[model samples]
Structure formats: C-alpha cells, structure tokens
Target: MDKERIIHRICALHETCPGNIVTEKEAISPELIGLNIFGEPLVGFASATDELFEAFKNSDIVGPWFLSPTEWLPEAKTVISLFFPYTEAVKSANRKATTHPAAEWLHGRIEGQAYLLKLIESLKKWFDDNDIKTCVPITDQRFEVVVAGNNFKQYSCVTADTFSSNWSERHVAYIAGLGTFGLSKGLITEKGMAGRFISIIVSKELAADPRPYTGIYDHCNRCGACVKRCPAQAISLAEGKDHNLCGAWLSKMGNLFKPRYGCGLCQTGVPCESAIPRKRRT
Candidate 1:
C-alpha cells in the first residue's frame, strides 16, 4: 500500500481502537474512565538504506550494538515511524505534578504503551494480509533494553551497553524525519516532545520523508524548561540529561507506584510540550 493508505489505516484504527480508551477497571480515578491516551499520530517513512541508520552505530550515537533496518528484516525497504502525542488530559495532569508522577500520567505510560503495541500488531497484520513482510523490532525476540543497575540478561541480538538498546525507537523516529532532539534529550517533533514513539521495518518501498532541518537539536530551542521541571534534577543546560540520575528517580517511582511508574515532568509545562518551540528573541 502507498503511504497515504497506510497512514489512513493507522489513523482510522486509532480512532476506533477500544484499547485507546481507559476502561473503568484500568483507570486510576473515576474521571479517567474515558481518558484517551493519545491524540492523532504523526507518521513518517525512511528508506531502509538511510545513512543515518549507519551513523547511529557510532560509539557516540546509539553505539555498535544498534541494529540497522536490514538486520531486523533482511528484505526491508522502508522504516515506518509513528509518534503518538499524549492527549491533553494526560499532559495536563502531569503539568501540575511535582515530586511524584500523576496518576493520569502513570496510566498513560503503562496503559498507553500497551495501546501502542496493540496498534503496531494491527498494522503488522495489515501488512501481512497485503503480502508485505514487516518486522516490529520492539516486539521481536531480539529486542533488548539494557538498563544500568538492573539484573541483566544476555540476548542474541546484541550485547548492548547499559542504558541502551539494540533498536532505539526515538533514534529510528529521528531518521524517519519525524523530529529532532531537545536539550532534555527527548525527541521534539512538530507535535512536540511530549509523546511516545514506535517504529517498524517493512518490505514495501516507500519514499522517505524529507528531514526539515540539518542539526540533530534543531527543534530544541534550548529553553531549559525541562531542567527546572525535573524533580530528580536529572537535566541541565550545560550537560543535558543524565540517564543515570533519571533512572534512579524512576527506580524510586517504581517502588512507590509498583505496577505503574513514570515521570513526564520534562515533557509538560514547557514551551515544547505540544509544539516545537520558537527560538528565543535575541
């Protein structure tokens, strides 16, 4: 199918997917029963052969552990990146939160991610039905995430360094022309840095979208709103985000919230929360 057709299917599925809605049993509060996890998504396509994929293998980038599209699917021709922005209900709840993650934000992280995976599975079925081969690296057996201080397990994909992964959705999204990095290290898209990303490799040859800017941090604006919002003090204007510090705070959150833990403070209550921030006037 063409890009338009694929986008249409995804958008349509998003609108009707029962998983996108917070059910009474899953909501943190009565008010959250009908909460929608995400708004309409923005999709972008990149050629499987994009040079950026190779660049991502560098030590300074995602590292040698990074897997290229072809590695995930030998016949891959395109990489489809999807960004799902959090609905206003989700973002607004977290905006006023301080030390702890808001209940709404927690649901968005845990349940919202479940909904995203469901969406991907639906798309995979669509591609298979069309006689197109596709691979969702995140759900694949080879997918592995290495977090420092966590009990580690070896995987066949790659011995990724701590705080890294064999396939990074955010990096993949960047290559797909969906957005660029912010000072907080979150990918800032046209829809803003407050969102979740997922990607897949396919055998369909789709024209890659043009990256609107050159620099990796072009859309950031360096406003540093995220720095102040961080309850963990994990971000800084001079050094950006410290994953270790961020991880420690998330760990603490995990203890408190158990089944659900998240902190989107850097994502909301900022200029880039819902849209790319304009450069500050000189």
Candidate 2:
C-alpha cells in the first residue's frame, strides 16, 4: 500500500478505536473513564536495509541483541514506526501532579500501551489480508527485555550492562525518521516527547522517509526543563538520564499504584512536552 493509504488507515483507526479511550473499567477514577489516551499518531518509514539498523548492532547502541528489520522479517522491505502522542487531558493532568502520576496519565501509560498493541495487530492483519508479510518484534515470541543485572549477554552483545532490550521502539523510530532522543532519553518528535512508540517490519516495499536531521539529539534543545521536572532527580544536564535511578523510582511507584504505575513528570509542563522547543531568544 502507498504511504498515504497507510497513514490514512492509521489515522482512522486512532480516531475510532475503543481502546484509545479510557473505559470506566480501566480508569482509576470516574473522571478518567472517557478520557482520550492518545492524540493523532505520527508515522515514519525506513528502508529495511538502512545502515543505521546495522549500526544498532554495536555495543553502545542496542548491542547485538538488537534485531534489524531483516532479522525480524527476512524479506522486510520497510520498517514502519509510529509515535502516538498523549492527549492534552493526560498531559495536563500529569502537569498538575509534581511527584505521583495523575490518574489520566496512569491510564495513558497502561491503556495507551494496550491501544498501541491493538493498533499494531490491526495493521499487521491489514498487511496479511493484502498478501503482504509483516512482523512486530515486540509482540513476537522471540522478543526479550532484561531489566536488571548483567545477564543481557545471552540476549545481547552487552556483557556488563544492567539494562537492555532486544528491540527498542525509540531507536527504531529514530531510524525511521520519527524523531531524536531528548535529555530524558525520550524520543522528541514534532509533536513532542510525551508519547509512546511502536514499530513493525513488513515485506511490502515502501519508500523510506528522508531523515530531516543527522545527529541523534538534534531535536533536543537541552533546556534542562526535564531535569527540574523529574521527581526522581534521574535527569541532569551534565549526565543526561540515569536509568537506574529512574527504574528504582518506577518500582516504588509500582508498589503504590500496583497494576498501573508510571511517573511522567519529566514529560509534562516542560518546554519539550508538546512540541520541539523553539530556540531560546538571544
């Protein structure tokens, strides 16, 4: 299918999907029952043979555990990456809370992810119906993510790292021309950093979107707003993001929120929350 067709389908799905709204059963409060979880999604495509995919095999990037598009789908011709930005309701709610995640934000994190998965599956089925093969690595049985210790060697080239995942949506999004990494390690797109990312590798040939920039952090303005907004103090201008500290904080939040846990303080009320922060006035 053409890029316009794919984009149109995705937009339509986002507009009508029941999963995109926080249902009463899934919401933490009655106020959040009908809250919209996500805004329109931004989609980008990359050639399966993009050199950046190979570069991701390096230890510094994603390690050997990082699977390229071809590795996920042998005949993969294009990698489709999507960034679904949180709705304004979610972002505003989170902005009001300084430490804990707001109910709307919590639903956005948990239910929003569920919606993304459903969307991916729908897209995959569409490709299947068209006799085109598709693979979503995150949903594949082979997908693996090591959150603690240095046992990632079995899954990656990383021998000493404490955290590693076989497939990273953010990294793939970058290669697909979606966005760049922010100071908090979030992918900052034109729509901003407060969002979730998902990707699929397909056999259908689609022209790759040209990357508008080269550097990995080109979109980040280094505003340090995220640093000050971090409740865990996990971000700093000098050191960037501290995943260990952030993970610990999330674990503590898990204890409090149970099945639904998240802290997106760094993502809200920040210069990069809703858009690429404009260059500081001289």
Give a tens-digit lDDT track for model 2, residues 1-282.
699999998898777766998787887878777888888899999999999888877665567777888998999999999999998999998999888999888888888999999989988888899899999999999999865444332222223435777788988888888888888888889999998999999898999998888888888888889999999998889877777788889999999999989999998999889898877656
TM-score of 2: 0.94
Give the TM-score of each candidate: 0.94, 0.94
lDDT accuracy of residue 79 in candidate 2: 92
Off by over 4 Å in 1: 147-162
What is the per-residue lDDT of model 1 for residues 212-244, given as tens digits with 9 covering 90 to 100?
988878888887889999999988898667777
Q: Look at candidate 1 and tell me the lDDT of residue 156.
A: 12
- Measure candidate 2: CA RMSD: 3.1
* lDDT of every predicted structure (CA atoms): 0.86, 0.85
